[model samples]
Structures are given as C-alpha cells and as structure tokens.
Target chain A: MDQFTLNLIVVGITFALYIGIAIWARAGTTAEFYAAGQGVHPVLNGMATGADWMSAASFISMAGIIALAPAGGYEQSAYLMGWTGGYVLLALLLAPYLRKFGKFTVPEFIGDRFYSGGARLLAVICLIVISVTYVIGQMRGVGVTFSRFLEVSTDTGLYIGAAIVFAYAVLGGMKGITYTQVAQYVVLIIAYTIPAIFISLQLTGAFLPQLGLIGTHTASGVEFLTKLDQVVTELGFRAYTSDSPNMLNMFLFTMSLMIGTAGLPHVIIRFFTVPKVSDARTSAGWALVFIALLYTVAPAVGAMARLNLTTTMWPAAEQGNALDGPAITLAEIDSNPELSWIRTWEKTGLLGMSDLNGDGQIQYFAEPPAVTAANKALAAATAALAAAGPDADRAALLAEVAAATAARDAALAEATIGGVSLAERGWVGNEVTRLDNDMMVLANPEIAALPGWVIALVAAGAVAAALSTAAGLLLAISSAISHDLIKGSINPNISEKGELLAARIAMTFAILVATYLGLNPPGFAAQVVALAFGLAAATIFPALMMGIFSKRINKEGAIAGMLVGLIFTGVYIFLYKGWFFIPGTNMLADIPANYLFGISPLSIGSVGAVLNFAAAFLVSGMTREPPHEVQELVESIRVPRGAGSATGH
Target chain B: MADKSSANAYWAANLRTIGISLVVWFLCSFGLGIILRPALRGIHVGGADLGFWFAQNGSIYVFIVLIFVYAWRMNRLDLEHGVEE
Candidate 1:
C-alpha cells in the first residue's frame, strides 16, 4: 500500500485506541479530573510522565537539533543533558515533597505553602505563562505531523488534532490523559526505535542504534564517528564530535533546561497521580528509564541521519554500488525514484535547491558566504590580469587562480565518496538554502529506503508524542484555572460537580487558544518554548524549592521572588528575541556579540534562578517570618509519615 | 519516644544524604561531562570520546542510579528514625 493510506490506517488505529482508553478511564469526580484519583501505579505514572515531558521538542525536534547543530558545534548536547538531568532534580528534590503536599496543581502548593492569596495568584500567573508558551509548540508540532502524514493543510491538521485532544482530555481529565499517555509512550518508543534499529543495521551491521553509533561502517569498514568527522570537516564545517565554541554558555544552557524541566507544572503534577511519596520518587526513576530509552538512541539517530543525508547527496563509489557513482545532479533529484523523498519535502517549502552557478549540480557544502566571496574575488583578479597588457605575467596569475580553485574543490572531492565532482562543483554556491533541520528524522527512513510501514509508524509516533504532551499541558492549564483560580479563589463554595464542569470548560478554552496560536504560530514555536523553560526555571522552581526547603521564606518573599525572576528572565529574552517575540521589537540585536556576560537568552534562566534565590532571601530577611502553622505545614511535608490519602479529603 | 531530637536526627540524615547525592550528580553532568571532558578526550569508547559519552549518555545513567539510591537509602533512614509512612 501507498504511504498516505498506510499512515491513515496507523494514525486512525492509534486515535481509536486513545479514545477507547479515555472512555474507559473517564474521570468521575473533580479529584479524578485533577489527579486521576491518586490510584495510579508507579510504573504507569512514570510512563505517563515520560509521555508528558517528551513534547514535540523531544520527539520531532530534539534529534534534528542535535544532529544539525545549526550552531555548528556539539553545544546541542546541552538539551540531551539538561532535559534528563531535570528529572533527577524532580525525583530527589521536588517530586516526593510535592506529592506529599497532596495538591491538585502546582499553584495550589505555592498558595498553601505561602499562606497567601496573592502568592497563589502569582503562582497561577506563572503557571499559565509557562504552560501556554509550551502548548503552542505542541500544537504546532501536531499541525506539522498532521500535514505531513495525513496530507492535510496545517490549519486542517491543527483542528483535527485539537478535536482529538478535546474529546479525550475533556472526557477523561487526568485519568484520561494518564492512560492515553501510556499508550503514546509505547507507540512513540516503538516507532522511534524501529527506524533506528533498521538504519543502524544498514549502516553499521548492528541492530542496536546505541551500539551502532559506536560501531564501524559496514560498507567502508571505518569507525562511524571517524567517518562522520572526516565527512563534515571535508565540507568545511567543524568535526561532528567537536565541542561548542563557548563552554560556559553550553553549561548554563544545560543547567537552565534541567531546572526548567523539573519546574514545569504539567510534568510536576504527574507525580501527584501516584499513591505515595516513595512512589513519586520511584515513578520519576521509571519515567527516566522510559525517557532514556529514547534519549540514548537520539544521538545515534542524529549521527546516522547526518551521515545518511550527506551520503545520499554525495554517493560513495568506494562502496561500489551502482547508485554510488556520482553526486546528485539537479535533474536526477527531480526524476530519480530513489530521490522521491526530496520532492515530497520540497512541496512543504522546508527543502529547496538552486543551481546558483547554473551548474545543474547540487553542491552541499559549508561557509557558502565565504566561498562565494572568494570565488568572486578570484574571478575578478583573473579578469583584471587578462585586462592588463600582454607583458603582464598573465600565465602565472591564471595558474595561481586555477590552483586556488583546485584547492577549494579538492576538499569536497576528497571528503565525498567516489571522488567525482559533478560538473566542476567548486564554483557552485550551496544548492539548498531551505534545508529545514526539523525534517531530518521524519525523512530519515525514507532517505534510507526503509519500508513504508516503518515510515507510517513514524507518522503515528510523532502525532502520539505531540498529542500526549498537548493533553498533559491542556490539563494543567485547565486545572490551574478551575482548581486554583475559580474554585480555590473565586468560589470556594463551588460544588464538586460544578468544578468538574468548570474544568472541562477551562480545558476547551485552553485548547481553542492553543489551536489558534498553532494556526498563526509565533515565529518558530519551538524557540518560544525556550522562553517557557526559562520562565519556569527562574520563577516557579525557586518558589517551590524555597517553600519546601525553607521555613523562613515568607509570603512576601515568595511573591517578590517570583515577580523579580519572571521580569528578569522575560525582559532578558525579550530584549534579545523581540519584545514578547513580536519579530522586530527587540531592543538589542539577537547575536552573541551583544549578549550579557556572554550568556545567550537561552542560558539566562540559570542567572534568573540565582537572582530569584537572592531576591527571595533578601526580601524574606526584611519581612516577618511565616506563620507558626505554615512553618508546621512545611515541617510536616518534609517527612513522609502519615501522608494523607489523595481521595475524599 | 520518637520526639523532637529523633525527628531532628532524621531530617539531618536526609539532608546529609541529599547533599552527598547532589554532589555526585553535579560531578557526573557538569564536572566530568563538561569541564573535565577535554581532559578525557583522548580516552575512546565505541566511536565517541569519553567526555562526549558522559555528556550524551553517561550522566543520564548516573542520574537514574542516584535517584533510586537516594530513595532506597532515605527509606531505610526513615525506618531507623521511625518515620516511615
């Protein structure tokens, strides 16, 4: 069967499974809506948490980011490190304590711990900001996956996704979101691994991608990394395994992501679904285990995809296959059945090519701006020499130009397989300017000539990942509005049934808002997620930590800390990336040259967190101490004894 | 007889364990994985250098182990101090 129909069947089956799980696990009360009645098993909760935590960024974008390293260094490893490391912080420092607090939402914990309506309101604002920013990315991801696999318009794809999530999440609440997420985790992991295994076997004669990454190339018998290093460097880019140019930025970026991961309200609330404090800790471990199954394989997928992409454009004749004889020409890319994936992606406008010198050959290389300038300068010099009198040593000047061109050309020829230059390739500018890095993974199986079913599975997996995380985030947003805002504050006397209705309404509103943003996404929705992580790391994380770990931190201090942290991180990001990310409204140019203390906006959250700690401590020193009862509450939460049941108050 | 002193002792033990475990976690990701990565560059494993391995894979492994160890040891401490749930 063709890919589109197969994709529909696979995606349809997964959607039906999700809806079935949602109906079976439907929430019956406000508590179930908020916390799944707190009866979920540790392993199950862990799997759900994995699904919630690994958003579109984790599934569709992360490996591509790590692989492309658009920043041209290994700095992207920070995502790999920081994201998983946050779970460590959660499991040890935050999750058990929060679970013990027996709360419905993160803001409620802050509200109760601080003993102030103002503090609770502040926490709610922060949660909404972080979650809303994050949900946009998930929504955009859903649109992309829908558009690609289902062959619908981005808007149509988004509405379909929003409708599916609305059905499951509104009906099931936390219970629905949790069980569906488990199914998603299973689907996403299998979908992720199958392709990696196939590609690994083809590339290195190893079935395990992790082992394959470190193994030798089956055809060339060279170690994979060594071959990769040689290939990328030949294209004038840094070696595949090289370190980032700025170590400090990488460190801070990783730290921020880790802290942010721990503080995300949706992820933190997952631990509350499990029964006991110890279970929260164990669930985090299980979550990490499931997460690691993909995280560990991601680098292998990244490296192998990078290798495969380059090799596809520049076939390796040394392997001596019939298709390995020449670099891909523009005409062949359009006509060759083997090159059909390129045509499919090109229609999305994410991939494009041009024969700048009219050479009719695709020249994929690095430092295009530099090469173009140098080539122009050489041509001009040669022309001027020819324009000079015949007495001028034109022969020598021409020879010098020829030699320079040959040297430049030699790199591509030596680095690629078969050493064949497609039509004197050196003068050609980089053929493809619109090679969207995000398309790498989705296009990988097709590039490697894997079977259509595996490609269909990838479509299902990407949608599952985006939907699962979107459901979790929508749940958080709805709960915050219902549990923390309306029920907790506006109408304390609201009935349980009334609150459940409010929760569903809140969820529907959140989905509509998310769908609208997904349709007209703020530029590069994923980058906005960095701002979300920053906000969470800076404001929410410190507040939660101080509320648990310190008795002296008063309500005034917590509120002050959150405001200071939020403004600090928000302004820093806005100053660099536009004001509220409105494109051209940035105060400073978004470049490393203008960064504060050499810290990029991506890494500024760590600094904001430190500033929060300092501000909270300093402010608390000036204010009266927390009330005696609040102090007692803190002390009680610190221990695991007599942890109250999550149901029936 | 599990009064304030015993409660205080239990908290102290938990804090101590947390402190030590956090130290190990820090060393694994930031220390060995990033700062000390350059020093370990010559040490090869599979296809990557030791530092790259630590950054991409080893630190995560260590984090999972650290959390489980913290939970198990803290549970034992809780029992010793008569604070088990």
Candidate 2:
C-alpha cells in the first residue's frame, strides 16, 4: 500500500478510538462535567495528566529545537529540565493543598481562600488568558501534523482538530477527556518510542535509544557524542554536548519554566479530579514517570536524527573521502527509489531546495565566506599573539584561537579538494536553508527509511498529543467561564443544569477563538505565549502559594498582589512584543542586549515571579489579616485530614 | 494551648521535610545541572559529561524520585500527626 493510504488508516483508527472513548464515558451531571465526579484513580489521573502536560510543543517541536540547536547552542534543554522540574513544585508544594481545599476550579480556590469576589474574578481572567494562549499553540500543532501527514491545508486541518476536540469535550467534559487522554498517552508513548528504538538500533546497534545516544556508532565505532561534535563543528554549529554560552540565562529560564509549569491552570485542575490529597501527590509522581519515558529518550532521538540527516545528505563516501560524497543531483531525487522520502517531504514545502548557482547538484554545507573569514582572522590573530610576549591576555587569546582553528580545520578538511580551496571551486550555497525545527520529529521515520506503518503510527501520535492537550485547555477555559465568571460572579443562583449548558457554550466559544488564532496567528504569537508563562508565574503561582503558606494575607492583599503581577508582567511583555502583540508597535527591541538586567523576554517570567512575591508580602504587611475562619481554613488545608470532597457546583 | 503547640510542631516537621527535599531538588537541577555544570564536567558518565546528563536526563529522574519520597514520607507524617484521611 501507498504511504498516504496507510497514514489515513492509522490516523482514522486513532480518531475512532478517541470518539469511542468519549461516547462510552459521556458525562451526565455538572459534577462529572467539571471534575469527573472526583473519583479518578491516582494512576489513571496520572496518565491523563501526562497527556495533558505533554502538549504538541513537547511531543513535536522540542526535540527538533534540541537537535537544530538554533541560534547556536544546546541551551534549549532548559525547556526539558524546567518543564519536568516544575512538576516537583506542583506535586510537593501545591497539588495536595489545592486538592485538600476540594475546589472545582483553580479560580474558585483563589476566590474562596481570599474571601473576595474580585480576587476570584481576577483569577478567572488569568486562567482564561493562560489557557487560551496555550491552546493556540496546540491548534497550530494539530494543523501542522494534519497538513504534513494527511496532505490538507493548515486551516482545514485546524477545523478538523477543533471539531474532534469539541465532540469529545462538549459531550463528556472532564470525565470523557480523562479516559481519552489515557488512550492518547499510550498511543503517543508507543509512537515516540518505536521510532526512537528503531533509529537507535540502526545507528548504534543498541536497543535502547538512551544507551544508543552515548554509545559508539556501529559503522564508525566513534562515540556518538564525539561523532556529533565533529559533524556540527564542521558545519559551523556548537557541539551537541557543550555547555550553554550563558549559564545565568539557562538557570533563570529553567526556573521560569518550572514555576510556570506549576502555575498553569489546566495542569493543576487534573489533580482536583483525584479523590484524596495523598492521591494528588502519588499521581504527580506517576505523571513524571510517564513523562520521563519520553524526556530521557528525546536527547537520543535528537542526536540520532541529526546524524541520520547529515549522513543522508552528505553521506560518508565509500572511498573514505570524508569531505564530499557524490552529490545527489536534482534528476536523481525524482528517479532514485531510496530518495523518495525527499520528494514526499518537499511537497509540504517544509523541506525545500533550489540550485543557487544553477548547478544540478545539491551541496548542503556551511556558507563559504562565514567559514573562511573566521578561520583566516583567528589564524592571523593567533600568529600575532604567539609572536608577542607571553602575557595573560595573549594566553587567553591563544586558547580562544586554538578552539576556533580546530573547528575551522575540521570544516576545511571535510571540504578539501586535491590542493584546491573550497572558495576557488564553484559550488551551490547550502541547498537546505529552510529546515523548520518542527519538522525533525515528523520526518525522522521517513528519513531513516522505516516502514510505512511506523510513519503512520507517528502521524497518529502527533494527532493524539495535539488533541489531548487541546481538550484539557478547552476544559480549563470552559470551567473558568461557567463556574468562575457566570456562576461565581454574574449569577450566583445558576442551576446545575444551567451551569452545565453554560460550560458547553463556553467550550464552543473557546474552540472557535483558538481555531481563529491558529488560522490567523500573529507575527509575535510565539513571544506572546511566553508572556502567558510570565503571567501565570507572576499571578497564579504566587497568589496560590501565599494563600496556603501565609495567614496574614487578606483578600485586599491577594487582589492587590495579583493585579500588580498581572499588570506588571503583561505590560512588560507588551512593551517588547508589540502593544498587545500588534505588528510594528513594539516600543523596545526584544533582544537580550535591550532587556532589563540582560534577561531575555522569554526568561523574564522568573523576574516577574520575584516581583510578585515581593509585592504580595508588602501589600499584606500593610493590610488587615485574614479573618479567623479564613486562617483556620488555611490551617486545615495544611494538614491532610478532614479533606472536603470535590463537588461539581 | 497544647493543641495549638502540637499543630505548629506538625507544620514545622512538614516544612523541614519540604525544605530538605527542595534543597536536594535545587542541588540536582540548578546546582549540578547549570551552576555547577562546568565543575561536574570533569566527571564522565558513559560517553557524556555529568552536567549534560543532569541537564538532559538526571534531573527529571531526580524529580520523579523526589515526588514519591515526599508523598510517602508526608503520608506517614500525616498519620503520626493524627490527620490521616
């Protein structure tokens, strides 16, 4: 069978399975709609949380970023560490206490704990903003996966994804979503692991991808890291195993991601579906174990994918010529059976090529001027310093030039002709300049020449990851609007049936908004989503932490702190990301050199969090203490006994 | 007065456990992974350095272990404080 037909069958079966689970676990009551009747077993909730937490970005885009090391370095591993590490904060500090509080929604807890309607409303606003921003990325993820694997336009793909999420979420609510997510987690992990294991065995003769990552390549017998370090340096990129250029930024970025992970409302709400505080803690651990299964193997997958891509394009020639193999001519791309994957991916336009100098052959290499100029300059500088006296500055310059020369020589050796300089030769510029980072995982199986069903399984896995996250975010948004906004603030007398209807309506509206954003994504949409992290870190995490940890904080203090955090982080992000993300309206440059205290806008969330803690403490010191009953309530949540049941209304 | 004192004592014990665990968490991720990364690079594991291992995989493993320890120890602490669910 053809690849297209196989992809359709696999993706179709997965969708049918999701819909079947949704129908079987259809929610009837308001309680079931909101918190799955608060009866989810710890392990089941952990599996559901795993699906919820590993969004399209984690499953699809992260490994690509790690492999590509875009903008030069492996610093993007902060995302891996920060995201996973944040769960520790959630599991240990936040989850049990919030579960003990027995609230239906995150905002409801904030409102009740602070004893203020306004605080509840503010939390609702924050939750809506975070979830909505997050869902846009998921929608885009669904669109990308569908367009590539199923051969549809991005918009049609998004609509298809939106419809699937709506059917399951609107009918079954949290109950249906919980079960579907479990199936999704299983599907995604298998899809992710199978390709990785296959690729690992192919590259290194190791069964486990994790071991393969650090083992010797079977063909070259070179340590995987050593081989990769040679390849990337030859291509003018940093080594795969090198340290981040800026340690401080890596440290802060990881911290921001960790706390931001804890603060995200969709993830926190998953714990509320479990029965007890103890279950909340256990579930968090299980979720990590599930998440780690992917996390540990990702680095291996990334390295192996990078190596495979390099070997395919610039294969190690049979005659031991390391520099250039017989180039794959344009005509051969269409005719060569082994080269069919290239033609297939090229149709999606993510993988593109053009003969720059009208040469029939494709030359995927570092730009000539960039490689030679740095090499010549460093060589001249080193010679000059060596001629001078042995001063401290000269010694430092010597060391720097030594590394640069070594890297340049590796490139030169690869591009060497029989005494002919690469510049003197006429060759096309790097033919593949548009390698989108998100394409790495999707294209891995095809690149490695895996069977069609494995590729099909990858397609299903991408869809599952996107759909599971989209459902969780939609649930969070709907709960906020129906439970926090309409019932808690606008209409306290709303009946259970009325609230359920409102929840479904809110979900429909949220899906539409997310689809619209996915279709017409703004230029700064990526940066703006980072702002969502900043807002979550600044507002929700601090407010939730203070509510539990401090008895002195009053309603006025909580409201004041959240407002300050919300506005401060929001305005700072808007200033650089364009006013409200409007194109061509940014007041300051978004680069690190332009940031306050050398913190990039992406890492500014951690700074916003510190400001939040400081502002809350100051505000609470000046305000009245919480009422005696509220203080006792804090005490009760602190201990694990007498936990109230999580109710729907 | 005695009941209030005991409750404070239980909270303190809980805080101590949290503090100690958090310290280990910080050491593994931020300390060993980032700040102390270069220092740990001299130590090799398999084909990679310790810092890269910590950043990519070790910290995640530590995080999972830490949560289970916190859960198991906290549950025992709850029972001892007469607050078991």
Candidate DockQ values, in order, are 0.67, 0.59
Q: What is the C-alpha lDDT profile of model 1 across A324-423, one tens digit per residue? A: 3445798888888778888777765557877766767776666444455655766776677768796888788888788767754554344331243423
After best superposition, candidate 2 residue A445: deviation in angstroms? 0.7
Clashing residue pair totals per candidate (backbone < 3 A): 0, 1
The C-alpha stretches of model 2 lying farther than 4 A from their native spots are A71-73, A171-175, A317-327, A366-422, A520-531, A582-585
The prediction achieving the highest TM-score against the true structure is 1
lDDT of 2 at B74: 90
The TM-scores of all predictions, comma-separated, are: 0.90, 0.89
Q: How accurate is candidate 2 locally (lDDT)?
A: 0.79
**Candidate of highest DockQ:** 1
lDDT of 2 by residue, A84-113 (tens): 888899987899999988877889899889
Candidate 2: tens digits of C-alpha lDDT, residues B5-38:
7778889999999999999999999988888878
